[model samples]
Target: MSTSPLPRPSDLIARRRAEVAALLATDAAQAALAIHGTPLLLLDTARVEQQFRRLRDALPFVRFHYAVKALDHPAALAVLDRAGCGFDVATSEELALLVDGSVDTARIIHTHPIKKPAEIEHALAVGVRTFVVDNDAELAKFSRAPRDVRLLVRLAYRNPHAKSDLSSKFGVGFHEAERLVREARRRGIRVGGFSFHVGSQLDDPDRFVHAVDETIAFMSRLERQLSVRFDTLDIGGGFPVGYDRDVAGIEDIASGIRPSLERVRGRYTILAEPGRILVAEAATLVTSVMGIAERADGRWYYLDDGVYGAYSNVVAEDVHPLVFAVTELDGDAEQATHRWATLAGPTCDSADVIAREMLLPDLRVGDPLASPAMGAYTAVTSTRFNGRPLTSIAVLSQAPATGEVAIPAATSGVGGPQPQTVP
Candidate 1:
């Protein structure tokens, strides 16, 4: 047997640039594109659709909802909308964004572990029935929602392999899912199903299966006890995507879980809220190195988009963001350290550090720095901490069949041309 050759990172990136160019060539978006912008995001809409389709085909029984919090760019949302995927939102702000973008209200699922009254009210008013509740207070809040809402009890994904401690932060424990389900039944609201998130950059593919199995067993026990069947089982997003070599590939994760999910075909409505997996590798954050400072001990690279605006995750979560030279740079050890070095943003605050002790090739002012896998939790979590304006954004499209990526000259926003068919 023979297999197809895998695509190299460079090859994949080049293909993405071409897709963007083709999208920009269309007369519709040419004039709207900003000729000059510092930091930008390039989205691969085609790749997203391809990934969604592949998931759908492989797990025909499951429903894949694109977590809009990943990349809410209008164009990207449009792609998911057309691909027949629903949107998952954590807040009313996100819900409004999708609704304003013309997303079908019927397809939206309001699923924040911690829901405020306004968010709950708006979700109810906006026809967002699907929700995930963890505690009694949240259940009480949902029970009193202005409209009838469908509830999916969130379960704890306590897999030790998960990078983030999401199990501790969100979801009712596996032992507690039944109680929540019963509470929903008692409230007279429809209990749609259950959900669980396995955390970010999950290296273990079986983690998903583990979560599903745990959810199913719990749901089954509850059904037998309460004599009620669940209508849905949301495997709340955490489909892994390779951001580095150490991370597992999409195929590995998908292949590992397909068999497990297939066994539960008739049990419940299988849905997913995939955020990082869907858009993590599809976009890059382009930032310019404003200046470089050298100390006797080390050197620092200052960027236009700092921890305040673009790299909020660094400070908020203390995550050492992956940084790369957008263009190439040439220098030596005293200048460039393979080991981690502290990188800060250009702001008055002393705590505005992007990545402390991050590995890099070299440093220079005015050089473009590219951060991959930034499509998720980067721009959407951005803040005008120092009144910095949001950087302009561009969307990229890829032909999955050919592994070709294009860099479309983006107009003001997501108003790009209808995608061109690949031969």
Candidate 2:
């Protein structure tokens, strides 16, 4: 039997544009725009809860720790915490975000392979027990900790194709992992099973299954040779999100590795660190054209927000988020003429260009544009360059009536007033 063809790049772009358009038309989007104006992010905690549920349903047996670095907004953390999602933090500051939110320390894990001694002490002080270490130096820091502290040996599986190959900076290879595990044993550190990240934003499902299979095999071999038992396996987060193109979903990746995990289901505690997938689609960015210029190459539209702001994911993760003019979503795009133009950010730096050769409708200086999937690594990685203020984020919730939107408050990072309704 013949199967349906996959979506082309143009089709994916159109779909994403339509999706962003729908978000812009929502009551919450309108309310945020009315109150906060342009260069704003509408964060839907309901969407965060939905994405978390999707990840949970996809991998029912695996305990998911929402990687705090993705988007550390208190609203996002509160939603995930309420949903009973654990947190994976890399630094004391991230842990503090959880702690300040009153998240139970039992649900937190320190995943930074290398940490300052003070950071380790802070985590331990807060009742955090599980930690990850990739080298002898890191393991040695935990040597003086209480006997109940357990560490996961980080193993590296390189995939250069991923947006970010985390293995390069923080994981151990086969021989190196063997050495670390043996070294940890010598120091009397409890090496809880193993943990590895295939890579960040990895699209290959087979890579995840391969990492799981390989790690399980290595764990078994070490258990036999070293006579040490490992009780946990953290398959680090790399689940891909379709930014400007179609990619594998959590269910697809979960299905690929579920069989292998099922083989050792009860024998080991399976854990996953999902950062991007859980929060990326939960936010939408709205920016307006601050200025328009006719450069030598073509027409250039300068938006108030750029790579230095919400679009930092473009420069850092190499993922291009689809940009749509508000007209495109309002059903007038087809009637308007389009041209290939460069979209730039409001910054003196040349590197602040958001999208090169973007096909957009003729937009005025004040026309609005929206980009979806702006939740992960966008605001968190944004910089206050050119003396510009960070773009404000408006936390959104649903009204009693279907399809209505409500803004609970302008969030903290934007330096806005405390919780107040945006009618």
TM-score per model over all chains: 0.80, 0.95
CA lDDT of each prediction against the hidden true structure: 0.68, 0.87
Compose the digit string of candidate 1's lDDT tens values, residues 31-117: 323444566665556667777777777677778788887777777787788889889998887888788878888888877878888
Worst 10 contiguous positions by lDDT, candidate 2: 1-10
Model 1's C-alpha root-mean-square deviation from the true structure amounts to 7.2
Q: Which residue ranges in model 2 land beyond 4 Å of their true spot?
A: 1-11, 399-405, 412-417
What global local distance difference test value does model 2 have? 0.87
Error of 1 at 74 (Å): 1.5
Shift of residue 226 alpha carbon in model 1, Å: 2.0
**How far does residue 48 in candidate 2 sit from its true spot (Å)?**
1.0
